[model samples]
Target: MPSGPWKNLSADFCGPLPTGEYLFVVIDEYSRFPVVEIVKSTSANETIPIVDKLISIFGLPKVIKTDNGSPFNSHAFKEFAENTGFHHRRITPRWPKTNSQAESFNKPMMKAVLAARIERRNWQQEPFKFFRQYRGTPHPSTGFAPFSLLFNRETRTKLPQVPTYKPNAVDECARQNDEVAKRKMKQNATFNNSPNDIHCGDVVLMKNEQKNNKLAPNLDPKPYNVVAKKGGMVTVSSTSGMEKNVTRNTSCFKRIPNTLAPGSVEPEVAEGEELILERKDEQVPISDSKSMPMQNAAPTLAPETIPKSKPTVQFSDKRTTPASNVTEPYITRSGRIVRKPAVF
Candidate 1:
């Protein structure tokens, strides 16, 4: 997670609510400020525009976290990340907790959406109300409204105006927040057995992330023997002597004990080919976002979609060629050479 506002953002598909539509939910990791856009599709094509909308409002993020869903895994998104100069990191399949920040808010948000549906209110209007309440209220963990954390000011709402609260309240809130987090961590530690660091020759079961295929196994049938460990990443090769070697994030695999029955052997795979999604390095040109720099006085603009259009290029300079039939003289910036009357 980034330590500053808008430095790192995580996005995920929210729903097929009553409308059968999805919401593209993006949150600033540092401030917890959320942006939930009602969207028609969750495909790469739809996601790129919504991401661009976020950039235009809050400036560009340095990194984006996403799942291995097709929207984030597409080649087009890889190109978009390269163009924006942001690293795109994908969380492991079946590991929603890795992206807890977004997922935590998502639960409450969906609950709100569902409640709106049950109340028979125009659910379409519920998202804005949720956004206002969520941003205006102080977060228990940070003891600050997400709006204040992100914008350094109170969101102007219908509530009565009041003086700034005391510093003691902020300090006490921080202490309470720390206590809550510690208690939660202690409870999780009771049942959570963090995986011991893996090493070369250790058999591991890789996640089978094949989409649209219900017949696929949850874990790949053949276990792979890790060949190397690089901090939080590992490179592994199949134990059956097949060439289906791959490098994936540490969370994407589970250690497979030898006591289990030997799995069916997998067919040989190409050396450079990959069975799952992995980060790709690419480069492309990108224009800077329209958002003002954070150091400047922030503008009071609501986050919304802005249509993009291809720039129209017009050249005022004209070209001259000596091979042409016409006898026009070349012009210079200083002055077209005053030519003596042609003595034809």
Candidate 2:
């Protein structure tokens, strides 16, 4: 026999600290009937009492499956299960699919919370109100409200209802008709096909290393579109019109149904000096002109002056000399001519 709804809770409220808004969801595996409880916290110590109350109301199931979380693995839970004689099963570490029954309920519950948050914007204080609305609603599959399924009747509410005559016979006939219509609809919608073969105009997904530079050597799936078909090879075109021939085998390309066309794949251009020059006629000098030989103008150097530390002694007593005696000569320190000056 199929299992009942996966029962678990998640914390969805975020605040300066956690608002303690925990989501408790129970889904029927066969009917998908959901019974959710939104509470401030679901600590094992705190949750034990809540679970006890729920079990008291719904009766203990043969088995309960949950993730390997601290609350589920707590000694209190273990002892409670042992005493109650309810089989407790925990999912393997890091494996969420093992507990998919609970995880699947998260999608619609989250959608409800999001919708409520958008409408009210202050959902933290009124989580229970949303939970009540969700629980009281009729499930699509079971054709029974969660409250009705759990309690065997419609729960009382403050809302007004129009007076109507009780016609149980008429209601039963209407339900039968609805069930027949639903069965017919399901039968008509069923499709039989192996999960392969690219359909014409069906946006088939493919992976090409030539398209994705970062893809590893191993044939991990990437995304491309099937543009045209020829025998076993399909002509695949990227958003950029870069076409490639691919095999129909699923090992080569994983087909993703109902995906939006990917954005254009821009061709990767290599950036280099040659490319830059091609784009713009701008030249950058590699070396300075001084480093290379210049065709014109000699390079000039200035004279260097030497400095003497000692002062020269003056031996001559007479200070003045006649113009005729002041001949153009090179005089030594003893006043003797060292050499006659050459005529210009």
Candidate 3:
């Protein structure tokens, strides 16, 4: 049975890679081989031609799967696929498991592309070289190069190798068969975890901690729909309806409830076209009565005058006549003063 993951190329190149930009990728579920093509755009008009060419080269796959993105789910692409008789399967709304093959391929391709751009500063032409190296290298699990698997033959390359004696034919055949069985078992396990098992319209929290941490608090905790689930991961879409891959564990995140303090009042939104306060038109009546002005009356006072003193006795004029006849005061034994008669 041809049951395995396959690459689904979506024509809607709405990313910021520039107008008319596009990315074409190929995936092999069993080998996990991925090939990417960068184009100008993913528009149906532009994509049809590319798809035709790829199909012609790779042959038609049983089912072509993709995310529920616009380009992949566009009416035009659907019509085109119907006409071509190819099954067009879309992954659940926000789920990515339906197209995990292509999505997984993008990771390494993006990393390599980024590294190339960093080293060369001109990465536009580096994809081809990287693709060639990747396809040529032997896969760790398959032990077969993608080029060899796709072409069914080993490509010639000049490389040094130690000469070794050939093993018995039977031994080599057994070894080869054992390797194939191991690869098949791994592929089976991968398909068992297909994302399609997730139910439609499931509410899932997306792991956006990295991107959200860089955003403002008001912009955080983006919600998404669980469009698909595969293994431990789920594909989620933002409220704006963009899909992204997220781990199932992260889909459990819930919006924190808006809470208020027990005694606090929540503010209400004010309504009404315009608010105008009622004001009285009349001016306040003021009393005109005035207290009588203090009169600037002059002070009344009496004039100051000096008092006359009486004259002392004139003893100096009569001193010449009274020198010899002047009476003298005498003190008696009892200490009393007495006046003596003239003794000239």
Best by lDDT: 1
- Against the reference, the lDDT scores of all candidates come to 0.75, 0.55, 0.55
lDDT per residue for candidate 1 within 1-344, as digits (tens), equals: 46788898888898876667998889888889999888888888989988987898789888899888988889999999999888999999999998888899998888787888889887778768888999999988888889988987788889798867555787899999999999999789656957566777778888887745877678877678899998778998877676877999888888866666276443554554423211133121112233322343332222221213322323466543223232323223442222223221
Per-prediction TM-score: 0.47, 0.37, 0.41
Give the winner by TM-score.
Answer: 1
lDDT of 2 by residue, 103-127 (tens): 8667765665577667976654455
- After superposition, the stretches of candidate 3 with alpha carbons farther than 4 Å from their true spots are 1-15, 18-20, 158-344
**Candidate 3 worst ten-residue window by lDDT:** 298-307
Report model 1's TM-score to 2 decimal places: 0.47
Clashes of 3: 11
Please write out the lDDT profile of model 3 over residues 149-236, one tens digit for every residue. Answer: 6655554556664554356897799999999999999899677744333444554333344553555353234555556656555555
Q: What is the lDDT of residue 149 in candidate 3?
A: 68
